[model samples]
Target chain A: MRKPKLSDEDYPTTGHEWDGIREYDKPMPRWWLWTFYATILFALVYVVFYPAIPLVNGATPGVLGWSTRADLAAEVEAVSLRNADIDQRLLDTPIGDLGADPDLTRYATAGGAAVFRTYCSQCHGAGAQGAKGYPNLQDDDWLWGGDLEAIVLTLKHGIRDDGDDDTRFSQMPAFGDILETGEIDALTQYVLSLSGQDHDADLAAAGPVLFEENCASCHGETGLGEREQGAPNLTDAIWLFGGDAETIGHTITFSRYGMMPAWNTRISEAQIKQVAFYVHQLGGGE
Target chain B: MTDQITEPPRLFEAREPVFPQRISGWYRRLKWRIMLGTLAIYYLTPWIRWDRGANLPDQAVLIDLAHARFYFFWIEIWPHEFYVVAGLLIMAGLGLFLFTAALGRVWCGYACPQTVWTDLFILVERWVEGDRNARIRLLRSPWTLRTARLRATKWTLWLLIALATGGAWVFYFADAPTLLADLVTFRAPFVAYATIGVLTATTFVFGGFLREQVCTYMCPWPRIQAAMMDEDSLTVAYRDWRGEPRGKKHENTSGDCIDCMACVNVCPQGIDIRDGQQVECITCALCIDACDTMMEKIGKPRGLIDYVALSDEPLERAGHPPRSIWSHVLRLRNFIYFGLWTGIGAMLVVALFIRSDFSLAVTPDRNPQFVKLSDGTIRNAYTLKINNQTGFARDFHISIKTDEPLRVDLEGTAELNVTVPPDGVLNTRVYIFAKPEFEANRAETTPVRFWVEERAEAGARTHADTVFTGDTQ
Candidate 1:
């Protein structure tokens, strides 16, 4: 090959020139040219292997015959298969039994977290930190017992419920009708004294006799509450309703019965047990 | 030094291509305003907050894929109502067509992703390598270290822009705050990273490299827009009657013509409007601003290049009275498009109004079709799936309605009370047994209705109907 000479006559140029500044008729870059050809080849391959070309009725199904719908179905099937063992285990094991296995417990907790966020998070916060009316699951203070069995029972049969028979039943009598205002005050002071709160010694001494008459049937002699009766312990520092003097007086004057909903018909029995364990492991569960 | 005088460097340098040094006019200012406004909106929308009660996402525009819900300020879309997304896509298409018919290719010029990205890329190019003339000189110059450095800087800026574009896109799919945290910690979901990678590559390829080619050759909108346009539609045009018999400045004795090529240089699509309208022209009107500036400088009146309707051009040429064709934009074609668009919108609204919170589906147990009881009662097994789309948990009271005195039996519980968790579905197997007398009275195929009533809310009810088949009566 001979070297080309650099001469004005040898160069191809645009016919028009401004003050001898000529435009060279150079071809496009080789890389750009190759890229163009490669892209056309890629498009041909893509059309042959994918649903690219539109036909009269529907798009052309490629040699692979793959579709977005099929891909989605396959993905769903894969996920389902991955979770099948855990799902089957969840179906087979009793909710109470779920907490015993750490793996199942982890799975249950994750599942319960999603369920709680969707269902219970409205009343109870997303973190299960309850509002004024809602009971906080993170706290140790539970109106009912905090064991898995107790929580399951509570979920299965709601408290003060009219429908189911096994519901936790407690009816504090209207002490307002039975006792005078002064007597109610004495009783409230007496109840507060059970938890070592300050009270009039003479009034508390006299209130013992009043307690034996009306409240001793449900609450035991020492003022520790009964679980079966759904009566709260008076001796404990944690209060379900409230511990203030006026609140105690109001409770005596007009007995408050807090209603807990039955979640058994709504959530699975196992889920209730899982939540119970989750709550039981929280600071105050007994 | 006096003997070496060089004729004052030939008195004038060669006029290089420099975008014809066009002055910014109304259209150019409008384009700048739109660019600034759109960019501001896009970058700031993610941070706007809307309180959606407690425990719900606060972002005004959120696609909570984890929750399978989309929240747009006051509106919330559930997964089951994905048809809303389909409706939105249809509305967008129709809106584009409407805008195209009224003012051709306006979206491609002002709002399209290709146009926006290409404009951004061009801005970066201008910042680093200077404007059109400087770019051409830099390309023609021999490979120097300074030129290489400038090229490198431009590419870095372009890559950064492409990355930012990709990064902003993933924020729409998840909670922007959480995803940002996860991304920083390298704990983002695999899908998020994969999506960003794909988007980054596409943005770099299409925005930085492909640029106007995406609009001119790749996009299908220009092809579709050709059919949508009519003679009365407004388009950027060259008034050849006013500008032809073109010649250089001081030599323009014919038809007020000046062969400056200002319009050609300022055109983003690189098309000559004087050659008449072509598919590549996005109608950006940079050319209008350029030509207007040139006309003003040459002591000629403006609108040698202007927006005009094809229908009025012939009439004006024939010396007939110019008819106002703005009213023609609302012709039969537009009316039909509007009708269909409104009809779809109205149907979606009505469907939204009638949407139910509770749904019931029945699946007949195929394994054992019918179980013959000891008391000669015919029994059929079925799995009833109940979906509660409400936000709160509901206590469902299930009852069977049949032609005969059919008794419903649950596997474990005596009461047919089901509690469906909020926004959840429950599948429970149910057994229906007919009394012997009722079985004797029943036909081979009997229709049975399963009704679910929410105890907490009395109004919420759903029903599923299925046929109970028996072996030889």
Candidate 2:
């Protein structure tokens, strides 16, 4: 054994030097060295017990023969087993009665959110806050209706969709050639005036008579827009195209029609119910 | 004269091994009992079966993370009731405070897992390689086949104990019998194996190797316990007033101390009781038992090293009798801590008993606000969520309370009786159609309460208050 009284100068040093400083080759701490070796042993054991080595076909099966896919399947199975009761109850309970039970409502809401994310989020933003032309599900403005049953019907048949016979179909006559340009301008001012927006008073006064004669049958005498006809409320701030005077004049002349695909063939009935339940709760659905 | 310069000692020194000498007395026996009791509870709790009807798990104490439920015998806690777990943790904290204020570090000395497991490892070491002197000699001796064999046997035993400790912990998270079978067959989850491996490594390193270093360096409790304690708190201390002026006993002229170092040898923390209280001292009182035995053998009074309050130390030095242990134990601070601890426990118990098994939550649809049906009646859509928390199936009658006549339609069905499965919820969309006359008289929003009553139980009912949205204008 080396003498304990040896000076630091006598200690072995690495050949490398920086400035005047020389590096001493001291041994690693005993506990740290042991811990490192222990981890290596643990890794070896782990490799033997779990899939580690890669092959042409796949990774090694390992001693335990476990796979991530199998684990995921088991987890998915466990969750489904847990939710089986709620799922059955949801299927049996009337869509209208779903809100009466808190647990079922929560389940439905969550299911609805998942469905919305998969199908509706592309058009209706992730939060169901709509983009232009796509109706915002979270606002108290609906072309058809905001009631649960009305929303469900809209989801099933959709508006002006091609494939479905029961699809909500409405056509506003394009008065571009039928009516004079001056009459269309007067109607725009009258439509703007209904919402109390700033407009030409003389034109609006002349516009109401034309509106009462032409628009009242569909848009309602009060300009509140008939839900049965899918006419948007002229008074509300929400507008699918644009609420400006020029946009209104163009819409009156050429006529505005928005098409939404029927979701009956795209998503399951349960999913439609779930999405309706979810959209209904987005601080919007009546 | 010139003084020779010498290098200063390194501030950080490698850990020195401790060889605590075996000493038997009340404290040691008490420590043994506590260690065995705690170990038994920890190992056997998961194995105890509970009968919670048909669908639930039968573990007496289980934290069912998979199901997001905590089952403790008869009490089944859902994820929403996690406040009960928080209350329990708070009670544990307050309990430690109460005990610490009354008796300093009684938990650390008698009940800490580190101390208990370290004591077990030490006992095993003593059995394999004799007591203190022999173990020290064996360590210092050059490696021989006999010494190597003894060391190997000791390590093997320590590893087994650690393995058992680790294996027992994972059983609490799963079904004990099934998991044990799966583990034996090497078919358990990889995480379970990993958990056991990690726990085994930690238990072995902490209990067998790091022992006292954990209490001194790793743990923060000793530092916090210092703040919890006061002068009146009872702690294992050396009665310096009686044993000071240390020397050989000569008649009544000198102090009774014989200058024996038995107290230091038997100390688990390797602290000298004569140096007053210290952070290193766990207050385990093994030194007291050693000192008492030595004093009795030498025909002197015991209690040379004993539990003494700092407040009593001055009194004893002034030739006055120390206050009784009860006088220190029943202080106002300790009383308050005890009261707070029990008060929370009582509140939790009350909440557990009074909470309803079912609940009704209604969310009225707001989009488009209210729809005007073709018949001119105003209809409001509501999503009702009925939570049935009971274990058995139940039939519920749904009803609504409105100021005026309202037609409630659930999927066009007029019947309000609903049957829900066990431990489930029934979700439904309700369209409440208010008569035009009713909407004309009521405001834009009317107060409506939705109620669900168990068909068999007279008073088992829950109700949610929601607005009856309408187009009043």
Candidate 3:
């Protein structure tokens, strides 16, 4: 091998000097130059093959014709295709029979939870904890019933809604207009006594006769509150509006009416079943 | 010493291109074996299948970024449990420190991917274009059709090796067989192709072309490794006490070196060992093999260039026996590093065994902290996330422990028992209603805890504490 001259005087200078040093004007390594060229070639080919350069009107559609939107659509399509079978099973299976298959149960419950968050969580809280007028779905106190079938029916027809003819409808007469104030006060004492709460014994004694005469048909003789009539049980500590003496007196005098919108016309059948199944699984569902 | 240090680069000086001659010895064989073992592990680990039950992936070692899970042979890591991975990285750092203190740059020489792949590329180059002399001749000669053909063949082989190197890396993130098929059919995801493309270009340029420059300049390990090595650390060194004052032949008249330049020709880094220790030396010990062969040819003692500790140089020059390599390797510094490395390893193992597969995390709703129900009851909402890390689906019963009379109510169903899918997270919206008395005597915020228990598995329980915001009294 020939030894390269290391002396500054022997080197071919580029006429650039600083601090008593001269530049040699040595060529870059051949392999390094070729690698640089190879990178440029690769970039040119990549530009031609992939969507890269932007034009005045729009981006250039390269040979590969890849678009981010199309890629996302394809990914979404693939996921749906994989889930198609489970979705179909959810639709075919009865909401009552959903608990029989664990896998299907899981799928429906997950889907139902999502559906509830979208639709049912407005009036009812996101956790299905009902507001003042709305029925708290988490409690054992169901205005209609708490069973899976009962929830399904309620979800379909709603309660006292004007749109649905089959909606559960009930109304208490405005006792303030019908009876004297003394009579409404006595009835509140009678209602409080049934729940085993503190009340005036003599007032309750006089209140039962009026309660037996006015509320026996739908509330039952024992005040268990018939599910068919959607009347809340007065014997339990739970109350739809309020269980206090004043509120009970006001409820009896002016009457209380709660309305729920039917979801059959609003949401799909699958979604209705899912939400019903979801609500039934809540701890309050019997 | 003055000859050892080069002055700052002159404006007119040209870089000396390194063209290392091939050599073989015990160290070379050891290097070849390590390269084969490391490369095999890298290329084949993702293909090894482990039956992870029905719903989970079967790859033995995988990083499932989509699911935020990492699976390694029997061990699985969740996103929240990334501390184990961090602990492992710390152990690796300590291990590097320990190994570097005992044996200088052994990791760089034997185990580093840059060293291993560069060696492989050089081997292929030698097989096609012949060894050092022939390659130098080819570089010096004028361009010819034969030389162009050889160059094309060498570059194509290098490209294929680089492609395979990159191809094996992507398999760790996905199912090996399925991704391989997808890649072959041009149906793989864009990220997969993009990753392979970037890695391919890097491997080709770094392994096939840059070679030793990666160790000397690009990598930070070599600099860190220099700090780890001490006077007692074993490194490839010339026995200059005997080999110096070189180039004479008569008995007792000259040193053993003979100024043959064999050591320089055989060095991958192309630095002269006679110039003393420099940061560029990787301690590959190939120069030792080369010098030993020359010594054997001249009927002189081998080991003119051999593994030696710097502290032993004075003793050996005074004609006293130097310390053994075992004595040099087993010192206080190495012992301390080993102790720290193993201490973390032991702690990690203990934590792994004690940790529960099921975990509960509660996030209380903040927007409307407390909602007053129709019956004059205050309700607080929380989003509960239950993580089931078991291989099979499990039923977890949710309950709460609080001093206040709080009723736990999950949104979906009346059932307290929730079936969490295998290796999945179940998010349930929960509403806790305070009793009438509790609501009447409310605090600004009440501390509450939500607990989860695996129904079938005893002792598998975890809980999360969250604040239940309520009306101030």
Candidate 2 per-residue C-alpha lDDT over B1-473 given as tens digits, one digit per residue, 9 for 90 to 100:
22332554342445666789999998899998999999999889999999876767888998888877788988878777799999999999999999999899999998999999999999999999999999989988899998999999999999999999999999989999999999999999998899999999999989989888789877999999999999989998988878877876664446777777789888778667887888878888899899999998988888999999999987899999889999999989999999999999999999999988888889887644565543346667788888777677889888899877788877457888888777667887787877667853346688898998989957598899998876654
TM-score of each: 0.61, 0.73, 0.71
Best by TM-score: 2
Candidate 1, residues B26-130: lDDT per residue as tens digits? 987887788888876776677678886455677888887787888777677788789988998898899878877878888988888788777777777788888
Q: Which pairs in model 3 have colliding backbones?
A: A132-B374, A281-B413, A281-B414, A282-B412, A282-B413, A282-B414, A283-B413, A283-B414
Off by over 4 Å in 2: A1-171, A176-254, A260-286, B1-6, B248-253, B365-381, B409-412, B425-429, B440-444, B471-473
Error of 2 at B362 (Å): 3.5
Give every collision pair in model 1.
A95-A270, A140-A284, A265-B419, A266-B419
Candidate 2 interface RMSD (Å): 10.2
Worst 10 residues of 2 chain B by lDDT: B1-10
Docking class of 2: incorrect
Ranking by TM-score: 2, 3, 1
lDDT of 2 by residue, A1-286 (tens): 1113334565556667899778765444356556679999999998999999999999888899899999999999999899888888887988889989988888999999999999888888786767667877766688899988998999999999989998999988897968788898899999998877789988877887889888999999889999899887888656777789999999899997878889999987877888898888765677
Interface RMSD of each: 21.0, 10.2, 9.4
